[model samples]
Target: MEIPIMFEESDAVEGHHDGLVISLPVAKEHGSSANIIMLDTLKHMNIDEKNIIIKSTMLVGFSGETKKTSGEITLATYAKGVNLQVKFLVIDTLSSYNIILSRPWIHEIRAIPSTYH
Candidate 1:
């Protein structure tokens, strides 16, 4: 379900919202190497479908279980007054966390997970 928000169409994608801020809940994994997002979340956010690249990825879980990915997408994500173009591996993991911010994101943000939390 899409959360209702009032904003100009141009400001929505431009990051020039003049102080508009939106919050999205997600999980962060310091141990994980790559960022991952639920396929359903991509659809709900109206992202990844238009510019998704067909690339398969193999992921090994903490317990050594494996999952194959369907595709990947690079999107400009805004948070805390910062705009970053982040890459996310797409898969139907059905996780409670729609997006898992991992090492790549943590490093990009120049933040230590231990201290961040």
Candidate 2:
């Protein structure tokens, strides 16, 4: 399914609560830059501040607006019998979703994220 992001669209998926977040391998590599978690989400997740990698990266939106990353952290994430050590890019910017699961993680798990609404 195609998800609209800015003027362009990304294969990146933001799932709803009821859908199982498991992935099946796909050949496309479109969402290489997906899977971002807001810093606010990280705060509630109880992650130690020491674990944040200071080497920040810059992310450009579909509309060409860039968002500078705050930091990064690799978490031992488990979902639907899948254990993935997910490295989440931390962003302090405002967004509607807590996390956008995509790319390597999606391909690894074969994710078909739940309906957006």
- Please give the CA lDDT of all the candidate structures: 0.65, 0.65
Q: Show the lowest summed lDDT stretch of 10 residues, model 2.
A: 22-31
Candidate 1 lDDT tens digits, 14-45: 43334322244332221178878888887777
Query: Over all chains combined, what TM-score does candidate 1 have?
Result: 0.64
| Candidate 2 regions with alpha-carbon error over 4 angstroms | 1-32, 113-117
Q: How many residue pairs clash in each candidate?
A: 0, 5
* Residue-level lDDT tens digits of model 2 in 5-96: 34223543555355544332111111245667788767766666677897688988879998899888776666566766778788997776
TM-score each candidate.
0.64, 0.65
Q: Pairs clashing in candidate 1?
A: none
